[model samples]
Target: MGSAVRIARETTEQVLAEWGVGPQEPCTGPVLLILSELVANSVRHAAVLSPKVTVIFAGGPDAFAFGVHDRHPYRPALYSPAVAGSGRGLATVMELTLELGGSAVVRGDADEGGKSIWVTLPLRRSGAPGAR
Candidate 1:
């Protein structure tokens, strides 16, 4: 678990750097933390027969989207964040996404053998929480 967290944090920082997220921007911490949590979820409970977790980090001129595809196809549910530890990972993701002016979603292919959880973070400040 500690190793996974380290890998996830390092990978996330590298990804954010690649995405051109500036040091002046507040998205760095939130994005990295969100990425870590999502990756942690996969490592902890995705029923991955293999330990490989595929992470995708993409950014355009306006938005950035981070995705992690795991082995299991069971989509996580949106539960109350106040439920003490029921679904804290996804909840933390939601909070971080909100802070980053983004959104997080979990989708799974029951027909297939995998699931992907994604968060799209916008680049511009106008796309942020109170932006019009």
Candidate 2:
């Protein structure tokens, strides 16, 4: 699980760097942290039902998005009482994303089962209004 988190972070960093988003960029830190929390949630909650998890990342000039997917059939709400013991990871993910002017959604695979939680955030310049 730790290795999974590490790999997710490293891969996301590399991809962002390749996209010309530097480590010190305003969106980079929150993006990485959100990815980490999503990946960790999948590992801790869905790993038993889904042995493998996938991380998907996409970005462009305006905004960047990523999703964490698992084969488990359960699709968790962004803020639900059912997710009590899972810690505050998802809550933190939501808070940080919204603070950065972003959005999140959970999509379930109708045919195959499982779900993917995706988050998208605008790429704001350091001095831009609302940049964090």
Candidate 3:
């Protein structure tokens, strides 16, 4: 899972760079963290015989969208953050997305028996009304 997290972080960094976003951006760290959590959760809870997890990253001039797909039908479990160390992945993703003026969503593929969890983070461009 550590390797998975590292790979996710590196991939996310590359994507952000390609999209003209810098590592110093306020949303960069949280976006990387969110990617790590999504990959870790898929590995921990959605593994199967092959245990395939696919990560997708897409960014437009205005926002970035990240997604993780796994070969299982399990939906992410949501829990109170007060709980110790368990069930905080999705919660953290949601919190960070909201802080970045974005959103998170989970979709289950009934026909394919798998799921994809996604988050969108808005970009605060220079000179925009709410730029930061």
Computed on alpha carbons, the lDDT of every model, listed in order, comes to 0.72, 0.87, 0.78
Top lDDT: which candidate number?
2
Per-candidate TM-score against the hidden true structure: 0.76, 0.90, 0.84
Clashes of each: 0, 0, 0
Better of 1 and 2 by lDDT: 2
Please identify which of the two predictions, 2 or 3, would achieve the higher TM-score against the true structure: 2
Instruction: List candidate 2 segments past 4 Å from native.
Output: 80-86, 127-132
Over the stretch 2-118, how does candidate 1's per-residue lDDT look in tens digits?
677788778777766676765456666667778788788788886456377888777886777878888786677644545336667777777667766687777775766787888
> Tens digit of lDDT per residue, candidate 3, span 37-111?
889988888776328889988878888998899878766544345523565667777777777888887787778
- Give all candidate RMSDs, comma-separated: 3.7, 1.9, 2.8
CA lDDT for candidate 2: 0.87
How should the candidates be ordered by lDDT, best one leading?
2, 3, 1
How well does candidate 2 match the true structure in TM-score terms? 0.90
lDDT of 3: 0.78
